[model samples]
Each structure stands twice: as structure tokens, then as C-alpha cells.
Target chain A: MTTRTTPCAGSEAAETEVILDLDDISLSFGGVQALESISFDIRRHEIRAIIGPNGAGKSSMLNVINGFYHPQKGTITYEGVVVKAMKPYHAATRGIARTFQNIALFKGMSTLDNIMTGRVNHMHAGLLAQALYIGKNRREEIRNREFVETIIDFLEIQAIRNTPVGRLPYGLQKRVELGRALAAEPKLLLLDEPMAGMNLEEKQDMSRFMLDINEQYGTTIALIEHDMAVVMELSSRIVVLDYGRKLADGKPDEIRHNKDVIEAYLGVAN
Target chain B: MFYREAGDFKTTYKADQAIFPIALDRWFVVTVVLVFLVVVPLLASNYMLESILTPVLILSIAAIGLNILTGYAGQLSLGTGGFMATGAYMAYKISTAFPGLNIVFVLIAAGLCAALVGIAFGVPSLRIKGFYLAVTTLAAQFFLLWLFTRVPWFVNNSISGVPTAPPRKVFGFLVSSADSDPIDRYLFVFIITVVLALVAKNLARSRIGRMWMAIRDMDIAAEIIGIRPLTSKLTAFAISSFYCGIAGALWSFAYINTVEPTAFDINRSFEILFMVIIGGLGSILGSFLGAAFIFLFPILLNVMPGWFGLEISVTLVTQVELMVFGGMMIFFLIVEPHGLARLWSIGKEKLRLWPFPH
Candidate 1:
């Protein structure tokens, strides 16, 4: 496991308390290490980016934080409580929501239905209430519908509201995916390759939405992305990973000129 | 222009999310219900009620049950027949055990019993999925069938291995018994189907339905999005079985009027599946359409040969019917895999855009 002693120099500048604290995180699939001794803190209401080339374990780190993968050695402290053996659904209930690298909207369902699913945790109506859809459940549904509609309107997806996500184009699907994640009203939102395979216009749109979400909702974001320009422009702090290890942890300006990061991006000699 | 929603406006989310959102659609449903309740019993012949309309109503209820699981929830279940049998036998036993219980309560109790059994079988689904989960549910079908057939206790130790539905009363009207009026039985089952169907439409439009669709769409994503697959999947199975159980209770008491293990066989499972598929996998209307197609199509074939002044052998007619049914299923599947419901929706869409290019 690679260990780095980077002082908490940036946290003092941001004035935001840590929302997620990963301590001595190490994960390996068989003998191949995915992440090694990585430690970082995502602060409250900050857009944080984990950027690296292929096989740098960016996606792996997001998976660990979301409780999709349990590291061999690590402690994830979420909201000041050390989440012990936390399940994915439990993480979701704790308000940790994420969008996938591949758009994962329910293909057979309308965009409205897909986004409404994000409110599943917020919804408390039981089976009989839902089955009957009367009084309490109906009111709950309409309330949630209003909430989801806000997301839809915010995302400007009214035209495709009734269309199946499967029938949507890739860019619109990505937008809808964000809408779904946003509908959760998550405290911490993770975006895995949110701008992957997008044209220039779509990427700009997504970057704008990401910025607006962070500013408007005060959502703490931890996004894994390959787009360096978007990462540099959008995120307040950047964590750079290389060969399953954290190379640098600082602001975007510090990351851009760090000697180690430069060498990591431009392959180091043996 | 007739189907346009130009003048009608939804003032609130509740009005917008109504089962029939448009005024015309709402009126259409009201008209259909009125015709079914008032006109069908008065105009239809006894033979049509007994051989065609009655079975369509009952089986559509069962198909709706299966559609909730296979279509909406994306859980492929082959244990539908077993669940129905559970309802049938439980209703029979309960009705006999308590002689004075209302028939309505007995049916509800039967559905609850089947729900318990459904939850038990659905436990394996948390681990298994897709066709493998389907195979596991198949075990439920066979196991429950074996239990019902072998256990004479379910049949009340009857010599015939058949558990007959005891006579019962609904709204002070004698139905679910031999010599009961066909129209009375039809009305009872029809009311139940209509009510349940409306309930299903409502459920499908609610948060619970969205969770099922999420799980069906992508379970891993669903879990990440906070849907507990265990609860969602099991709830789907339980509710689906409950609907099937009621349909079974109604089938035995109202339609079939005789209970045998063979009645809820694997063929019945396939038939229900066919109904959901042909009717439209995730649609209430599709369930009725598919059931009508399956039941009434055969009757049509039986009468068509005579209408054409051709005398065909009964066996040959049956053969042709099977071939024609298989061919039609393939045709529908190939033409529009979404089933008759999609076709109906497409027509509605066209109507909405009629007299205009776009």
C-alpha cells in the first residue's frame, strides 16, 4: 500500500467540515491492487474530483465510498460516524447517491417514473397504502411527484418526460441520469464518468448542471472523471491518483503544476 | 379532435396523476363499466356468459396478477398456477371450516394465505435472478401442485380428490353455488375484477410501482438508489399472488364451480403468461385483451367453421385452433412485442394527432 503524508493544507482554506473521511483505504481483487492506502476527505458543499488515467482506481474509490465494494483494509467515516460494513442501500438511506458511468435508468419506464424512483427512500407508504393508492399514499405520491417535477423542470426535460429512457439519446439519458440522482436530494452525490463520451456542447451543459447543483442544492459532490478541463473548471479541490495510489491532494492549481503529478501523467522512467 | 385534451386541463398533481388522466379516457372507462354492469348481463346469452365472457373476466384477473410480477416488476414467475391453487384450496377449506363466514372474507383470507406461500417461495429470488429465478419459481409450481394433489386434507379427505367450493352469499344474493344465476355470478366476478383492476392501475402509478420498475430496470442501480430488493421483489410476489389467489377463489366459486388440482396446472400458468404477453406485459387492458384472445378466439374458431358451411371434425378443429393460436401469438410478438396494449396506445396516440401530420 502506498502511503502519502500530505498535510491538511487545503481543508483550512475551504472552511468546510469533512463529510466523508477515508482512512488507510486499501482494496485488491485477487493479487491485483485496485486502490492502496488511499486517504482523502470530501468536504461539505464542495465539488471534489478524483482524476487519473486508465487503471488509476478512480472508479474503484467511488465504488468503495458508495459501499458497492468493501475494501480489504479501510474505515469509511460518513457524517462523523464510522460506517461499519455498510450496505449500498444503507449508504443510499444515509443520503449518498450516485450516477453510473453507464446510464442506468429503468429502460422500460418513463423518465418520470425513473426519477420518481429516487424518492423511494423518502417515501414511507406501505404495501396496502400503495396498492390501494388512497388518502395517505396518493397524497404522498402527489407530493413526491411535485418534488420530482421540480427536478424535471430544473433539468429542462419536460419534452421527454413521458418518453422511455431506453428510447432517449445517450446525452439526454445522461441528463436524465443526473435528474434521477438529483431527485434523491442527496447530501453527497457521486458522479462516475458523468461526461464520458459526450460532445463539446453536452459536456458544457453537464458542467453547468453540476455547478448549478453544487451551488443551488449545496450538495457535496465527489466525481470521477477523465476530462481534465471540466475537472479543473468545476471542482473546488482535485485529488489525483496514479497506479492505485494518491499522487497529490490539493486545489486544482496545485495539482496542475505538482512535479509528482506531472511525472505521473507523463510516464515516469524505470 | 375527438380524442384531444385541448379543453381539459389538470389543475393539480393529483388530477394529473389520475388513472385515466384525460377527460375522454376517464369517460371511456366509465362508459365501459356502465356497459359491463348494466348492458352485458341483460343482452348476452347464457352460453356467451358461461363459455366466453365469464372465463375472460376471471382469467384476466389472473393475467393481471402475473403482469404485476413479470411485466411491471420484471420478475419472471412460473408459480402463478400454484399461487392460484393455494387461493382455491384455502378458500374451499376456510368456507367449509366456517360455515357462516361471508364469501368475500373467505376470498380475502384465501388471497392472504397465498401471499404467505408466495413470500416463502419468493425468498429464493433474493439470490437467484432472471431465468434461473424463473426455474426456482417453477419449483414452487410443482411443489405446490404436488402438495395440493397428495394432501387429502386440503381436499377434506374427499374420495374424488376434488375440493368443491361451498355455497356462499354476497350482498344477500346467492352465488358461487350450483343453480345460481349466471348473471349473478358474472356480476359478482365482474365487480371484483373491475375494482381490483382499478386498484392495480392505481398501484402501478404510485411510488411502489416505480420501485418495482427500478428493480426491474437495473437492480444494482436500484439498490444504489435506496430500493431494498428483498422487500420490493417480495412485495411484488406477495401482491401478485394475492391477486392470483383472489382470481382463483373467484374461478372456483363463480366460474369453474368445481375445484380440482388439475385445474391449476402448469398449462394454466402458461395460459396466464400468454395472456399477459399478448395483452401487453405491463398493462391492465392487455390482461383482458389477452384473456379474451385466448378464450374467445377458440370459440370463434369453433363457430367460424360452421358459419362457413364446412363440417370439420372436432379433433381437426382443435388442431387448427392450436395452430391458429400459435401462429397468432407469433404474429403478434413479431409485429409488436409490446402486445395489444401497445397497439391500443398507438391508436390512441394517432387519435391525439389525427387531422395533423405531426
Candidate 2:
């Protein structure tokens, strides 16, 4: 894979610092190659969309980025540190947070509690202090809770704050999942099909949330999305993958006109 | 109407995050504590204190411990009796060795000892879950009991393998010896149980509690979002065992005044598990409710035949008790899997919407 760090022509490259760089990352499950020699860089404060058809290894790419799946080959550089392999805890502590392809909210916990779990790394009180629920523990809880309330406001899930996520509808659960990921105050957010199974109205709401998250928080996002229209509208840049291989990489319009991407993913017109 | 939360506005997160956020709940808890402290001691007979309330409180602690692991952390364990034995034996050793140590310090030290053992047993939980982890803990149960029973050192070289509680005093009042006043023992166990239950409630609402629940709900997602499964699972085991240990210590020192390894056998573990399940898995109140029901129901069964003027034999009563307990377990599992605590909460919810139907 060639170095493709230069932003496509006609796009702003002022914030050119690469927050995460996947260098020749290859992963497989026995005989099947899930992601082969995929090199990509997620820039700071950019909505980097990973677009692919079925079996294109989009989720696999996100999994590798978040340290859920360690590649058999290559290194992942995050914040300029070349990490050969990362534990999910290490990835999360280093400001990498993600939402899953299927909504993975804690089903037994209240929405507020689910979001509060995102701040586990930030909590430092000892067992005794927490057991007593006084002084430092109480103070830390209130402080983190205040921060979480802001995310609750952003996601507009205040009505269901105390409702268990399992009881919520799909769109609301997805929103709660987003709220949970956002609560981590991540430097890079990996979203796997953030709008999957949502109606058009929910899709628009999620798209607005993605744009607002990118613009307001200045968080770098790498998303695996199947909705072409949503991807075109939300992503600053797009990477096309086909059969565990990179097909094309460029701005949304550039990928839209890429012949190979059209033939492989969009399909050819008669 | 009595359970209504109307006009109870919280202006701060601290108030909002309170264990009893509702003003009515706070008042209700305060009233219950007052009754236990001031009224129950003054009114209850020696038999009532020793056989019923005291055992309920002690077993409630063990139930809470099991609840933290199975109910909240989602790690099924059958090591409650074994961990309790560890605590009971540890307390015996600590008090006997120290001779002049306060009972509070002894209890805490015993609980710590049990927590360490719990952590060791908890290590297997990292690789195994559900019934498999339960089976591993079942091994802990048998091994711990066998170690205590076979090793004369645990009973301090007693021929009968029974360790007796030496006389211990708290605030100049005898609390541990068999000759101690029943009221003093009841109060001692009651105070400790109340404080420990509050602590358990606090832990359940804190970040650690959230971590346990996260692991319980979906461990993969929990790890991805950065909850260390090892620490969470171990802490659950440690805290649970600590509670069980304290309960065991009190059982030997205060409630029974003498304990054999048989006191904390497989039957005891199953009893506590029953309490946790029937009370509520993830609720602190459920632990107490479960303990009360399991302990009192047997006594009630024994006396119930007399009240009805029936000529039921003792063996028949025992058989009926076993059958009824089994039937109730199935009934609760199917009707209200969350246990009696969930039922209590549902009642409160209904109270909030009284005089109206939605």
C-alpha cells in the first residue's frame, strides 16, 4: 500500500496530524483473510468514512483499530506512538472509544449508568472510599456525573436517563450507545454502522449528531457505514474496501467517480 | 400516595445520586433503623433475638455477599459457605491470638482474610463463566470445608473439631460468649449488619458497582469501553466473601457462640444462594428480604401445625418445609425472576400511580 497521507485536492488539510495510522495491517481467521495489508490514516478532527459492500471487512477494520482484534501483521500508531499490539483497556485509556455494529449498551443498567461506565478510567477512588460513599469518591462521582449530563443533553436522552437500555427502542438504544462512547471524551471515535436499521428520520438525526460531534468537540471519527447517501453527506473523506482489500481512497466526490469503486461496490450501469 | 416522589426536586447530582433519592425512602429507612435499634431490643424475647432475628441478620450479610457476585457481577459461586468458614476460623484465630483485641477489629481482619481467599478462588472466573465458574467455586466450597475440618489447627486442636467463641466485649457489654445477654448479641449483630448493608448499597451505586453490572451485562462491550474484567470480577468475589466471612464470624462469636465446619457446609451455601435468588440478585434490600424469608419460613412451618391443631410429626414438617421451599423457588423464578425486592419496587411504583390506571 502506498503512503496516502496527502489530502485529496480541493480539501482543507490544515489539521493534518494523523491521530491513528494503520501501517500494513493484515488480519485473518485461519483460512480466511478478514483485512489484508490495509493501510489507512485517520486525521485529527475529520470524519473518515469506511464504505464497503457486504463481506468487505469494514467491521474488521474498525475492530483492528480499537484493539479488539490484533492484526497478525503491522503496527498501529496512535498519537505518534507505534504500538505493535494494544489491549482494549489500553486503547480506551489512550482516548480511543468505539460503538459496536450491534448496539452494545449494558442491558441491565440504566441509560445513565451505561454512560457512567464510560468514565471508569477516570474514577480513582479506592474500594474503602467508594464503599463509604464520602469525600473523594462522592466528589468524583458528582464531577463525572456533571460531565455525563452534558453528553446526555447532547444526545437528548434525558427523558430515558434512568430507563434501562434494554427496554429502549433500537434508535434510542443507538443514541444511548453514542452517548456512552461520547462520555469517554475520546480523541478518536470508531463507530460501526452508527445508523444501521434506523429509519430515514433516525438516520438524519444520527447524521446530524455525527456532524455535531465532529464540529463541536473536534473529535476525529472513523466510521463504518453502509448508507451511501449518509456517508456522502457526513464524511469528509472516504475509503472504499472490497473483499478485504482497499479499492479506492479519496474525498467523497472523488470516490463517487472512482471507476474501480463503482465497478466493485456501486456496480456498473449497462 | 404515601410512596409518591412529587415535589421532591434534587438540585445537585449528589442528591440525585443518593442511595435513597426519594425523600419518603430516606424517612422510611430512618424509621426502620430506629425501630430496630430502640424498639426491637426493648421488646423482643431471648428466643426471638437468638433463633430468629439474629440468624436472619447474619445470613443476610452472607446473602448480600453472594448477591454482589451472582446478582451484580454475574459470576455464579457456590463458595459462600467455604468463605464463611474462612472468616469464622480466621476470627477464631485472630481473637484467640490477640486475646485483647476489640471485636470490631477482629471482624474486619477476618473479613480481609476471607477477601484474600475469595480473590484466589476468583482467579478461575477470568477464564470461566456461568455454570463452569460455579463448578469451580463449588470446588472451593468442598476444599475449604475439608481443609478446616481435617486441619486440627483451625479448631485449635479440639477433638470435636468445634471452635468455641471466647468471651468478647464491646463498649463494656458482653457480646460474643454463649453466656452473653441475648439483647447485647442481637444489637451487636444488628448494628454491624446495618452498617455493612449500607456499605454494600453504597458500593452497588458507585463506579465499581457499575463495572460489575457492565461485566454482567456484556463483558466484551465492557472491555471495549475499558472496564478491566479481572479487577471487576475479583473485587466482586472479594467483597462478597468479605460479607460472608463477617457473617460467619458473627455466627460463631455472637449468634451460635460455637461453630463446627458443618455450620458452613454445602447446605448453608445453598441456603444463602436461595436467599440471594428469592430476595433479588442485584438488590441490597433483596438480600435482607431473602434472608428473612428463608430463616423465618422454617420456624413458621414448625409452629404452624400447632396453630392449626394438626397432628403433623416433626419429620413431616421438615419434609413439607423442603417441598414448599422448592415450589416457591420455581414459582418466583417463573412469576418474578427479580425476586421479592422487585416485587417491593413494583408495589412502590403502583403506589406512585394510585387512584389511576395508565
Candidate 3:
């Protein structure tokens, strides 16, 4: 067990409020417990990292947050609202967006369209308006396209905007996925290994973009990353999980020295 | 070189988002439309207009509809034939009940009626998916045909259970009924199909289209991105059925003159599905191409043996046509699952980069 340390007094992180909190969430599939009694908090305008070994329920936690899986016993408080049961659509509409561990992009569609889909909640034109491509529908489409274009520009993926995402390289696909999550302009962006398959250059680029996203848009990010150095560099606070149980939750430096976390990563001596 | 877009710069998102972004492509479309609307009508024979062109155009509309549902939205529906029956019956009922109504309004009303039925059938998609959902829609196909056949009200209490569309005129030009000219019917069907196809294209490129594709590509991800499965699936169903409905109405009223419930049976459903598949699942142009190929291929098969100076029996030609059709379908599916539209686009892509191997 590692002692949880509070944010240092008079710091910007301490001044921010908690945007999302999970109260003892437990998830299971049949008899196998994927996540058990896990609790964490993500503060506004901060990058919170959840780091653990393989099958430590990191992706499961993201799935629960996005309402893809329902925990048998838990309460989720997002932006001051306590939700008993959240649907994925409801979470998305309430400003929660996420990228998958494996790329879950619309492969048949172009990169621009894939990102534009993130603006689905913002578009409200009726079928008739859409069919005719007049007035409100046309205007709404152009507006969303412009917003998506800005994201493409920001992600430096303008060259592949018209290319189908399935044909894109792995690193670019990950970037497009992040761009899609960003297109929603989410309050809390959940990234599941945003730099999982990237090379050193791509990983550096992704880290910089994540930092810029945190600084520029002030988006509260909760990411599950395995690279200890990048995780330590990017996150303000870290949550260590071992076998679905929280081992430590504190600043990155504290987590690096936590006995339980070290054992969970390298194993205990015989 | 003509297909190049090098100098054509789009300054606005609106320009970039235009259906044909390239100036030359826009002009090519305009030229094709002009030739079809003006030149073909003036030069085409009665047999060409009635037997080949009009039916192809009408079926193209249905293909576009199915493409929207199954191709774009990734909802497998075997209810197209039934929805078409609903449209045919509804058009018959509306035009007869309200003789003073415009022919256009009658077709539109029939489509709306089918849309309502489509929404009802689309409910199962939320709970079930893939082949299971397809089975539910297959039930809709049988039930709708059964409803139209068993209920006398659909056929206006006619003993034969077949309804003939009363002669109707658009802009004082007779376009429906047995006595109407083939050119008028072809032009009418052509105009309606062009409009509907354009609308389908627009919907495909817009937010709704993207929503459908997202759901098709990944429903769980789409849901997390704020798309409600119920709304997206149902909308695809409603719109797809609407196009099929109008196609059905045109099939009975404008082309066939009178249609029985048997006209839109399970075979017709399969036929339309084939058109969507062969045309391209998620492409408006693929729907048109598939429709053209399916409708015209048999006629071509029958004539080709004669043109080659071979004296072939009618029965032999028919048998060979069937085998060839089946073989071609398999060949296309295996060779290019995306259908003719993808091939067409690939050809265009190659043309754009001609004289250089990229």
C-alpha cells in the first residue's frame, strides 16, 4: 500500500475542482472480476494517468467511464451530476468523449468524415433539410466541416483528410482517433493508450499534442498509458492499479516510489 | 489531364463540400444529365424508353434506398419488396380516394406511408443485429405482401386483387395509365429518380450519412460519440423505404400499368438487394449502375447470341442467361465486394494520374 498525497498547497492543480469521480466501481464478466472496487478522481484542466500492467483493468475502467460496460455496484459523478446508470449516448452528449485502445475508426469513411462524426451531437438538422441540402442542413454541414478541418490542421493530418482511414498508417490512425475525440470538444477526454503503437518521434508528437490539448482547450484528460516516462511527464496525478485494485493514487513522483506499484510492475521477490 | 483539379482552388468549406468538388466533374455530370434528359428522349425508340430505360431508372431509386439502409447504415433489411408493395398499394389508395390530387403528391404520400411502416419494422434493429435483424425484416416482406393480398381494401375491393393506376397527368402531360406515351413516362420517372438520387447523395455526404456510416462501422463507438442507435437505424430505414416506396409506385403506375401483390414478392426483394450489392453498398452511383446492369443484362444476353449470327433457341438463351447472371454475381462479389462504384472511382483515380505510374 502507498500513502495518497494531496496536491501541494497554493498550486493550480489544488485550485481546480474534481470534474469526474468514480465511487468504488466494481465490474465483472460472469465470475471473472475485471474491475473491483476501483475509485479515482479527475480534476478539471489536469491530465490524470491511470497506469498498470496488462489486464490490470485499465481499459475496463475506460469502458465503464464511457458507459460501454455497466458496473454492478458504483456511482459516477460527472461534472456535478451523479449518474446511477449512464448510456454511452448520454455520456457523449454530456461532454464525455473517448478513443479506443485499438483503433475503432470508421474505416470506410475518409479522415475528415471520421472526425466530423464527432460533431454528431452538435448537428440537429432534420431529415428533410438534410435530403434537400438547403438552408439549415447546408449551413450546419459547412460549420461542422470547418470545425473538423481545424482539428485536421491541428493534428497535422490535412494531407490525408480525404483518404480513407483504413488505408492510413498506424501512427496516423491513432492521431486521427485523437483528433476525433478532440472534435467533440469534450469536457473530459478519455484516451486509451494514445501512443501505444507509435515510434519515438510519433510518441513525442502525441505527447506534445496531449499537452497542448490540455493547455489550449483546458480539457480534463484521463488517459491509460503504459510508458512510465511519458506517463510521468504528461500527468499531474497518477493512479496505480494492480489486479483491478487501486494500489496508489498520488503525484507521479510518489507513484514511481510506491512499493506496491513497483511490486505490481516487477513482481515480489520469492 | 482533363480530370485534374490542380488549379481549382476552393476558398470556402461550402465549395469544398460540393457534391462534385472538381469543376470538370461538375460539368461532366451536367453534360450527362443533359444528354439523358434531352437527347435520349428525342432519339430513343418506344421499346428503349419503356422496356429498358424507364424500368432501370425506377429500380435505381429502390437500389438507392436499400443502399442507404444496408450499405450506409449497415442495417440488413430484407423488407424492400414489402415496403415497395406498401408504396404501390398506398399510391393506388391515395390516387383513387383523392382523384383531384396531383400525381407527384400521390407518389410522395405513398413514400411517406411506406416510411411509417419502415419505422415500425426498424425497431427490431436496436435489440437485434446482422442476420437476426435481417430475419425480422424478412418477416416484414411476407407480412406486407400478405396484408396487401388478403385485404380487399388495398385493391379497392377488386376481385382480381390487382390495381391499375388511373391515368394521371403532370404539367398536362399524361405520364401514367396504359394509354400514356412511353416518352412521357420515361421522362417523368427519370426526373423523379434524378431528384431522389441527388437527395440520397446529399444525405450520404452530410451529418446523417456520417452517422449511418459510423453506426455501420462501429455501433458502440457511434453511441459513445453521441449517436442514438434507435434514431440512426430508424432514419435509415424510413428514408430507404421511402425511396423503395416511390420506386414501387412508379413500377406499378408508370411502367407496368397494373400490379399484383405477387409483383413485389421475395424474389423482388432479392433482386433489389442484388442491385444494391452489385452497384456498391454505400454509393449512390453504385445503386444506379447496379440497377442498370441487372435490368439490362438479360436483354443484352438475349440479343448477343443473335448479333453473333448464332441461331439459339429461346429456352437455351434463357437458361444460359440465368447461369451467366449467377456466375457474374459470384465473380463480382469475389473480385470487387465494394461493387461497380468502387471500380468506377478507381478508374477515375487512375485517369487523374494518367501518363505516370504512382
Candidate 4:
């Protein structure tokens, strides 16, 4: 059934559902054609997975959506506002956050401190506030600490809160990276290969976390993963990119049965 | 274990952010400061006071400045002595030209001039980093030093090209080079150095200091975090050169008395850098430690003759002092890679728990 209905009076749709529309985005990196006419639409509260093999431009596609790499052609409209060529920080400040393929936590700082740093843009306290550290500044600092503590509790990293991020295990590091991203309180969370190098148990835990983030917080998640089974289980809609092109876009079952997807995954099923 | 913060509590933020939060560490610093100010002056001979304490303190201020730019901001520089020369020569030209002007005013004017020079050199930091930046600063050092020597106006057409710091009264008391009593000069340098050190310490904990440290740690991350690197680095250079200029003014007015174009030599720049390295990168206390070590060595070298009951020429002793200084620098680099500041921190870490250490 079509979910579309007549526009209701005295109600704002933006206040309810968010739209992430990437329209005919074409991008090239030097001699390599990284993405060609790639288009995808992500709705609020839905889990969207972009699954593909290595060198399939999956990461590049995500980077484009988040404004890390400005596309040579095309437009990305988030919440009805078209995003032009802008730096990564611009996206960060505008309620969009992402975690890297390799965990990019500030290694020298504590896990709690690393997460707290993610709130740098959001924090109203400036340099003067930092220096004098007066009434409101102290209050803000306490507030920041409290906010970080909640994330630490959510991730169950209370025991290692004071520990440096560099010394933590890889799975824990990935969790910390996720914590940092979540610290930004982004409306759209982009996870690039979140389960890239995780063990089965870790991957399951991450999937649960992702689901919790979606169901509990109502955050829209766009992920890139190699695990087909996990992708089928988690995503309502799957985006398959092959050689800088969208090979398949449909429901989990539809993608699973698609002959083109089968050919792309198993090389003609030989 | 003894060296744990298991029970020692910091109820206040100020306490937590102290230069040394531990009670024992605090006392140790107090004790050291007391020894330097009160005990040393009484015990040490006039010649020792004149020759060592004053010079080391002056150099310590300069090192702290360089540490701000190079150590904290990650903008490597080799033109420290040139900036120092800028201060010294400018002070000389001004003080000699306008004998009626307060010595303090001349020193400040000289510092301002050196700050301008520092900013000029700092412009290159925007274009380069690491070794390339260091080489560019080295060019500044060579050029500035050359200017002082080649330009006749700098020395006021004096045959010797080294201006003499005339007998000058500060608040009705004559503090002058004509006295030749190094004690009075040492006292003047001591008061100024302490004031400068306190100011530097305050500045370090300021907004600019955090910005510099952020840039130093990771520049790209810093930019994204909203810190402008150019603004932070240039400010660091200006403040650092200002200190170097002051030190240079003190070098001529208090210690050297009559300076030459070669007075603010390249070796002096290396000496200041070594002070930071041996003391600790990004540590004010380290600069003082470094200066004290360098300052004490030459005097100890002078005293070796009386202790050993041997006759070594003063020139040979000075040469040997340089060799020993060079050797000690290498030894410190190998022994404590993080410098004396790290050693101090480690010692404090152990002492934090004291008798209960595992």
C-alpha cells in the first residue's frame, strides 16, 4: 500500500519525518570514476545498508552523502535543504556525524575525553570561557562531563572511562568511535564498514547497538557492510554498488532473489 | 601502591589543575625557590652570583618563549638568537641615543622590535612545517645577525660597535655597569625573571596556550575543532620573541655590560634550545632547569682548578666546559628522552604514594 496521503493541516512533516535525498550524484577521484550517477533516498527511522565488494565505491558514496568529498556533479538534499560543496566539519556542525572505517578516536586522550571532544562544536563555551572557567563555564564543563558519562554508561565502558583510547581492544575502539559519533547527537548517522574487522560476537553486539539506536533513539542509519546475512537481517532497504554504479536497490528478499545481484555477488553463479 | 591517587582527593578544580597538586611536590618547589632566592645569594661568592645565576635566569626566560612557539605550537625555529640580538641591539641604540629615557622603556621598545622580526619569520611557518620551517627561521637568524654587524647605524657608529650600558638609576637608586659589582645587576635580573616566569605560567594556562597545544597535537583536527593555526602560531612567535628580546637586553645591560655584534651569537640560540630539550618540551619549569644546568656548568668548571689542586688554563677550562656541556646534552637526550620535566613528573608519580609503593 502507498504510505502517501493528503497533506494534513496544522502539522509539520519535517518535525515528524526527515528526508535524506541524494539525487543523481556523480563523482570522480582523479583518473578513477568513483561514482557514476549514484542515487539513493534514506528516510528517518529506517536502516539503509549500502553493500558491495572491495573497490566498489561504497565508502566513496557515503563520503559524498556526508560532504567529505564534494561531487563533480549532482545534489544532496537533507531536510529539503540542498547541500553544496562543503568541508567535513560543516556537515558535522549541521547534525550529521559519521565513524571512520579505521577507528579515528584521539588516541592520546581518555575514552571519555575522546567522546567529550566530539561535542566541541556543540559546546557554547569559547576560549575565554575555557580560560576563566567562571560560573556558567564550570556549569557547562559539568554538563559536558555528565553528557559524556551517559554515553559511557550506554556503551558500558565505565570501567575503562579513564583509560587512553590507544590501549583499548579493536572492538572496544570501534565502540568508542561510535560513542564519539553519537556524542555529536547527529540526526543522520553514517557507519562506514562498522563491522569491518569485528568477530561474530562483536558484530552481533554492534548490530544490536545499531538497532537500539534506530528503534530507541529514532536515528536514521546508513551503513556499509560486507556481511550479506547481517545486511539482510538489519536493513529494510539494501543499496548494492558495483564499479561506481548502483547494481540493485530493493527490499532484502527482492535483492536476495535479484538475478543481477546474484551475478554481481557470485560471478554468474558458476 | 604508594604512588597511586587512590585516596588523595581534589575537592576543587583549582587544586586539580595546580602546577603540582600533591602536597609534597608543592613543598619541594617552595624549598627549591627558597634555596635559589635566599640561600644561594648568601652562600655563593659575588663572582659566582655575577657570572652564573643572572645569566642562566635570563636565558631561562628566552627558552620558555621558544618552547611556546616550537615545542607547544610545533613550529620549529632556529632564529632565537637573532631575535635576542634584535632586542639587545635595539636596546643599545635607544638607550645610548636617548640617555634620558628609562632603561625599562628601552628594553620594552627593543622587545617590540624583535616581536615584529619574529612575526616576519613566523610568516614562513604558514608555508612550511618541520625541517623546512626550521631552515627558513635559520635564514632569519643569519640575516638578522648579519644586519647587526654590517649596518653601522645599529652600533651608533661606535668604533667597537658594542654599546656600553651606562650607569642608570631606577627609582633613585643607581644600577649601573660602572659599579662592576655583579650582585646589584643579578638582583635586577632576578626580579624581572621571576615576574616574567609568573606571566608566562599564567599565559600557558590561557586560551591561546590551549589553541597552540591543539594545533601541535593534530593540526587538521584542530582546524575542524575551530582553532585557526595561523593566528595561534603567530601569537606564539610574537610572545616568544618578546621574551628573547628581554633576555637579550639583560644580556647587554646586566651581564655582558659592553656587548659586541657577536654577543647574541648562534651558539646562544642552540643553548636556549638545549635548555628546553633537557628541561622538557612544553614545560616552563623545564626551561628553568635547563638554564640552571647550563649556567652552573661554566662556574663549576672555573672552580675545578681549586678543588683538584691543578693548574688548567682558563681558556682550556672554558673549552672543556663547552665539551662537557655538549656531552651532557647528548647524555640527557639518551637517558631521559622526555627531558628533566618528565624525570620530575616520574619522581612525583612515585612519591605520590610514597612509603606504600609496591
Quantify all predictions' global Cα lDDT against the true fold. Answer: 0.88, 0.91, 0.91, 0.78
Q: Flag regions of model 2 displaced more than 4 Å.
A: A1-15, A266-268, B355-358
Instruction: Quote the positional error of residue B156 for candidate 3 in Å.
Output: 1.0
Q: Report the C-alpha displacement of residue A64, candidate 1, in angstroms.
A: 0.6
Q: What is the TM-score of each candidate against the true structure?
A: 0.96, 0.97, 0.97, 0.80
* Candidate 4 lDDT over residue span B169-235, tens digit each: 5666555575756666776777778777766765565445655765676665554444556777898
Please state the error at residue B123 of candidate 4 in Å. Answer: 3.2
Expressed as tens digits, the lDDT of each residue in B200-303 for candidate 3 is 99999988999999999989888899999989999999999999999999999999999688779999999999999999999999999999999898889999
In model 2, residue pairs whose N, Cα or C atoms come closer than 3 Å (at least 3 residues apart or on different chains), thus clashing, are none
Docking category for candidate 3? high
Proportion of native contacts kept per candidate: 0.94, 0.89, 0.92, 0.07
TM-score of chain A of 1: 0.93
> Deviation in angstroms for B244 in model 3?
0.5
User: Interface root mean square deviation of every model, in Å?
Assistant: 1.0, 0.6, 0.7, 4.2
Docking quality band of candidate 2, CAPRI definitions: high
Chain B, TM-score, each prediction?
Answer: 0.97, 0.98, 0.98, 0.90
lDDT of 3 by residue, A36-85 (tens): 99888888888899999999999999989988899998898988888767
Docking class of 4: incorrect
Task: For candidate 2, give the DockQ.
Answer: 0.82
> Higher-DockQ candidate among 2 and 3?
2
lDDT of 2 by residue, A1-270 (tens): 122243222136425888888888899999999998999888888889998899999998988888889899988998999986788988899999999898888999999999999999998999889999998899999999999999999888899999988999999999999999998999999999999999999998898788778767878888899889888877878999999999888889899889998899657866
